[model samples]
Every structure is written in structure tokens, then in C-alpha cells.
Target chain A: DVKVTQSSRYLVKRTGEKVFLECVQDMDHENMFWYRQDPGLGLRLIYFSYDVKMKEKGDIPEGYSVSREKKERFSLILESASTNQTSMYLCATPGAGGSYGYTFGSGTRLTVV
Target chain B: SQQGEEDPQALSIQEGENATMNCSYKTSINNLQWYRQNSGRGLVHLILIRSNEREKHSGRLRVTLDTSKKSSSLLITASRAADTASYFCAPESGSQGNLIFGKGTKLSVKP
Candidate 1:
């Protein structure tokens, strides 16, 4: 079975602190994504990487950045965490062209105090 | 901006009843997908319907797509308590290698 692993299940950070969320997938997928989910807004894409060392900004990339050092691993970085950044962060990988739906890692719920 | 919007923000049903959710999108898409997310967990793919296809079924789940209307629907038959979760629909942005998901419909199936 395809497996996507998230490094942390829950995290708490102080305001203005830097934060990192990690995700690794064993399927050797070519696409990786980071999204933040909120109550009424749903999942907003923060960043996406189509290949190692290549990243693209998504709709809500203002507060987030992504790094894909290896094909199996993608990381989301919050340069400076804020109270409004508290939300459930999800990592996902989809088949080429997204012909198959995405496989998401168990999300990381981050709370900025 | 959100590419899709799901209707009926929440639904409550009893076991053995059917649950239906709708999704509408703004622009053209290559495909539409349905996913289920248990509380505090990541999403699990349920079904995918291509742009050309009208409807598709898998086991107890059925999905329909209407490109003309840029809308889709997901129906889960014979619901069970385990089916209680938030269901979301996503449309694949053409050639972007990403999916745009909408606010989901929270379903509660009472056993």
C-alpha cells in the first residue's frame, strides 16, 4: 500500500517562531503539495513541488514556503508563525497529471500561541 | 480562490440510509474526485470521474459529473457509522499536477 508519513501529528509554537512540517511518501510520486485547512475555507494550497528542487506557489503561499530536497520528501516551512496560522496542515501527492486522486499523509495540526 | 464549492455543509443520516453530497466548480477541469476524511485524519480517495464521463460507481459509492454544469455529486449507499466523516470534492486543475479542494460536507451517520 502507498504510505505517506507526516513527521508530527500535533505541534504548538509561539508567535514569531519558525516552524517546520515534514512529509515523506514511499510511492515515488512526482508531485507533492502542502495545504492548510480551516473551518469554513477548506484546504488552501500553500505550495506544490512537481519535482525535486522545484517548487511553485499556490493560492495561499503568502505565509508558507516549501522545499523538496528529495523525491520522497517534501517540507513546509513557516518563516514566522502567527496566531492566524494555527490550522491543520496537510501533505499530499498525486499521480502524474493527477489522473489518480491524491494520497494524503496524516495531517499535522499546528497551533500558534 | 477556491475552485469548487460543496453544498449542504452538513448532513446527518441513519445507518442504511443514503447520503448525497454535491460539488460545483468554476472553470474547466480534467477530472473530479471525491474523498473522505475521518476526524483529525488525512483524506482518503473515494472515487474519480473524468471530464468526459458522466457517472461512475464503485462498490457502495457512486459519483456523477456534469461538465456542462461544472458540477458533480457523490452518493454513498447503505451508510454505516464508519461512514461518518467529512466528504470533500476536488477538481484537478489542468496540467498543474495539483487539485483544488472545496469546503467539505460533514456527514454524521448514526448507528
Candidate 2:
């Protein structure tokens, strides 16, 4: 089975602290995405990368940034964490064989105080 | 704003009963997909139905799409307690494969 692994399952950070969330996929997919899921707003894409060293902003990329230094890994960065930035962060990649659908990793729930 | 909207924010049903959820979208889409997320977990892709396909099935799950109405429905037959989770519908933008997801329907199956 294809797997996307998130480095952290839960995190707590002080307001104004810099934070990093990491993800790695083993399927050799060309695409990776980062999203933040909130109660009523659903999952909003923060950023997505279709190739190493290339990234694109998504619908809700204002407070977040991403890096794809390697083909199998993508990272999300919060320059200065705030209360409103606390949410469940998800990482996903398209299934193998050029499918448009995705396989997601277990999420990282971040809590900023 | 998201492109899709789902009905019945929450639903509860007994095990072995069927559960249904609906989603509506505002614009043209290349395909519609259904996903399930367990509490505190990432989403799992359940099914995908292209705009041209009216219906599709996998295991006990059935999905129907109506392009004219810009809506779709997902049905889970003989649901189990394990099936309790939040279900989301995503419509892929015609140009890019990027998906806009709807607020999910949380379903609870009691044993």
C-alpha cells in the first residue's frame, strides 16, 4: 500500500514561535499537498508541490509556506504561530500511476497558545 | 468559499442500516470524489465518479452523480459501527486537478 507519513501526530507551540510540519510519501508521486482542516470550513489547501523545488499557493496560503526540497518529502512552515493557526494539518499525494485521487497520511493536530 | 456544499451536517443510524449523504457544487467539474475521515485522522479516498459517469460502486458503497443538477449522493449499505466517520465530497476543477471540498457530513452508526 502507498503511504504518506507525517512526522508529528500532535504539537503545541507558543504564539509567535516558528513551527514546522513535515511529510514524506513513498509512492514516487509527482504531487504533494498541504491542507488545514477546520470544523466548519472544511479542508482548505495551503500549498501544493508538483515537483521538487516547485510549489504553488492554494486557496488559504496566507499564513503558511511550503518546501519540497526532495521528490518524496514536503514540508509546511508557520513563520509565526498564532491561535488562529492551530488546526489539524493534513498531507496528501496522488495515488500511483498518474491518478488524480489522493492518499493521505494521518494528520498532525497543532495547537498554538 | 468552497465549491461544494453537503447536506445534513450530521446523521445517526443503527448498524446494518443504510446511510446516505448528498453534495452540491456550483460550477463545472472534471470529476467528483468522496472521502472519509475518522476522528483525528487524515482523509481516506472512498470513491471517485467522473462528470460523465452517473453511478459507480465499490464494495458496499454506492455513489451517484447528476451533472445537470450539479449534485451527487453517496450511499453506504449495511453500515457498521466502524463506518462512523465524516464524509466529504470534493469537486475537481476542470483546469487543474485541485479539489475544492465541502463541509463534511458526520455519520454515526450505533450497534
Candidate 3:
């Protein structure tokens, strides 16, 4: 069974449209992270949530927001999707004891036209 | 800047050949780990080597760490086309469980 699953494997949106990418985990996790991967750029953290209703800004949080209302669900929102924002977005959840180096989702390839 | 940067951004090798990838870090670390990613899929954890250790092996993969030189290497023996993927080295850093990942080395193994 897949433990962490992203809502969409591929997504397409207009340049000014608002987009939402979802991640759901079945295992008990204390922390979650959102990252974007681009060619030649690797992975850059966009947001991280330590606990329910708590979140932190990562290295590149601009134009993106996150919501963690429940323990198992974390959502990444793009307020106004831009063409440059088109990239593969990944979500990771570490172990319950605060251990990292966790597994990543299959990733959502977002394309903002 | 404490992360490990992979060398030789891209590599091409034939099946049955051995592939080696190197990682150079900027600072001291307690441990280092390697990961592999297929084309568009998520990364899979490969191996983890502690600072005090010299080398570790699993299956056809071997990892070596030299803390004094702040460098690490991953060796994949008897490679196959299925082994074609991007390899990343992560050096554990600081207090939190922050793993720094640089641009990975993309490997292409031809059958």
C-alpha cells in the first residue's frame, strides 16, 4: 500500500488561476514538508508543518501557501499560479519521533500555462 | 553550504560496467546518505554511512565515507539498464534532521 499519496500526478492551470495540491498520509507523522523540484535546481522547500494547525515558511515560500488543518492532510496552495511556478511539487512526511530523511510522494507535475 | 554536491552531472555507461558517483561536502557531519530517483518518480533511500564508519555495502551498492576529507562515494557494481537514475548524496547537518541535497548526478546505463 502507498503510505503517502499526492492528489494528482499531473495538473494544468491558467496563469492567474489558483491551484491546490493535496497530500495525505496513512502513517502517524509529526512533521510534514512541501518542496518543489526543478531541473538543475534540485528540491527547494516551500513550506513545512510541525503539527496540526502549525506551519513554517521554507526557503522559497513566496507565491505559495499551505494548510494543515488535520493530522493526516496537508495542502499546498498557489495563490496565483504563474508559468515560472510550473514544476514538480513534492510532499514529504517524516517519522512520528521527529526523524527526517523521509519518503517522498509520487509528485504532482503542475503546469501553469 | 554544508550540503553535498554530486560530481559529473551526467554519466553514461554500458551494462555490466561499474558506476561511481562522488559527493563533496562543505562541513563536518554525523552521517551521510544516498538516494536514487527514476525519471519522474520519487527518490528512494539507498544507503546511509555514519561519520565514524569507513565503508558499508548492500546488495550491489557500496558506500564509503571519509569525514576528514568531507567527501563520500557511491559505487554500483555490475550495473544494468534498470539502474539508470539520478543519484543524490545528503549530508546530515546541524541539530535538526535537515538533509541538504544538491543537484543530483544523472546516470544512463545502456543495455
Candidate 4:
């Protein structure tokens, strides 16, 4: 089965600290996405990359940035963590074939205190 | 602002009963998809319904699409406790193929 592995399952960081969330997909998919899931607002895309070194902002991109130095890995960065940034972060990729469906990482729940 | 807005923000049902969730989208779409997320976990793709297809089924899950209404529904027959999760819909529009989601329907199947 295809897998998207997240570097951390849970994290706690102090406000104003720089934080990094990592995701690695076994499939060599060119497309990858990062989203933050909240209680009622649902999942909002922060950024997505269709190729290495290429990225685009989604609906909500404020306070977040991404890195795609490699094809199989994508990373999300918080310039300076804030209390409002505490949420579950999910990394996703299209299925084996692009656009058929999606495979998502287990998610990293970040808590900025 | 997002496509595929779901209603009935929450639902409660018994183990042997069926659970139905609805999603509606605006503008044209290439396809629509449904997903399930367990508590504090990433989403799992449940089913996908293309624009031309009216209905599709997989295992105990049935999905229907009405492009004219720009809406879709997901029915889970004989839902189990394990089926309790948050269900979301994503409507893909344009060639970008990026997904946008609204508040999901949280289903709780009681034993």
C-alpha cells in the first residue's frame, strides 16, 4: 500500500519558535499538499507542490511556508509559531495515479503554547 | 470560501442503521470525492464520483451525484461503531485538480 509518513505525531513548541513539519511519500507523485485541520473550519490547504522547488498557496497560506527540495518529500514551516497555529497538520499526495484519489499522512498535531 | 459544502454538521445513528451525508458544490466540477477521517488522523479517500457518473457503489458505501443540482450524497448502510468518523467532500474544479473542503459532517454511530 502507498504510504505518506509524517515526521512527528505530536509536537509542542513555544510561541515565536521556528517549527518544521515533515512528510515523505513512498510514491513518486509530483503533487503534494499540506493542510491544517481545525474543529469546525475543516481542512484548509496551506500550500501545495506539483514539482520539486515549485509551490503554490492555497486558501489559507498566512503564517506558513513549504519546502520541496526532493520529489518524495515535502515540508511545512512555521516562521514563528503562535497559539492560533496549534492544529492538526496533514500532508497528502494523489494516489498512485494522479487525480484518482488521495493518500494522506497520519498527521502531525502541533500545539503552540 | 470552499467548494463541496456539507450539511448537518453532525449526525448520530445506531449501529444497525444507515447514515447519510450530503455535499453540495458551486460552479462546474471535473469530479467530486468523499473522504473519511478518524479522530486526530489524516483523511482516507472513501469514494470518487466523476461528473458524468450518476451513481457508484463500493462495499457498503453508496455515492450518488446530481450535477444538475451540483450536489452529492453518501449513504453508508448498516453502519458500525468503527464507521464513526468525520466525512468530508471535495469538489475538483478546473485543471488545477486541487481539492477544497468545507466543514465536514461528523457521524457518530452508537453501539
Using TM-score as the measure, the top candidate is 4
* Per-residue lDDT over B12-72 for candidate 1, one digit per residue giving the tens place of the 0 to 100 score: 9999999999999988888888999999999998888898999999999999999999899
Candidate 3 chain A, poorest ten consecutive residues by summed lDDT: A94-103
- Model 2 chain A TM-score equals 0.95
Candidate with the greatest lDDT versus the true structure: 4
lDDT of 2 at B83: 100
lDDT of 3 by residue, A4-80 (tens): 88999999999999999999988868678898999999878889888899998888899999999998899999999
| C-alpha lDDT of residue A64 in model 4 | 92
Compared with the true structure, what per-residue lDDT tens digits does model 3 show for residues B20-98? Answer: 9999998878788898999998777788888889999999999999888999999999999999999999887776666
Pick by lDDT: 2 or 4, better one: 4
For candidate 1, write residues A1-113 as lDDT tens digits.
67899999999999999999999999898889998999989999999998999999998898788889999999999999999999999999885444458889999999999
- Model 2 scores a TM of 0.95
Which residues of candidate 4, in runs, are more than 4 Å off? none
Tell me the tens digit of each residue's lDDT in model 2 across A1-113. Answer: 78999999999999999999999999888889999999888998899998999999988898788989899999999999999999999999877633337899999999999
- lDDT tens digits by residue: candidate 2, B9-90: 9999999999999999988888888999999999999998988899999999999999999999999999999999999998
As for DockQ, the candidate ahead, 1 or 3, is 1
Question: How well is each residue in A1-113 modelled by candidate 4, as lDDT tens digits?
Answer: 67999999999999999999999999788999999998878899999999999999998899999999999999999999999999999999988753358889999999999
Check candidate 3 and list the clashing pairs.
none
TM-score of 3: 0.93
Query: For candidate 2, what is the DockQ-based docking class?
Result: medium
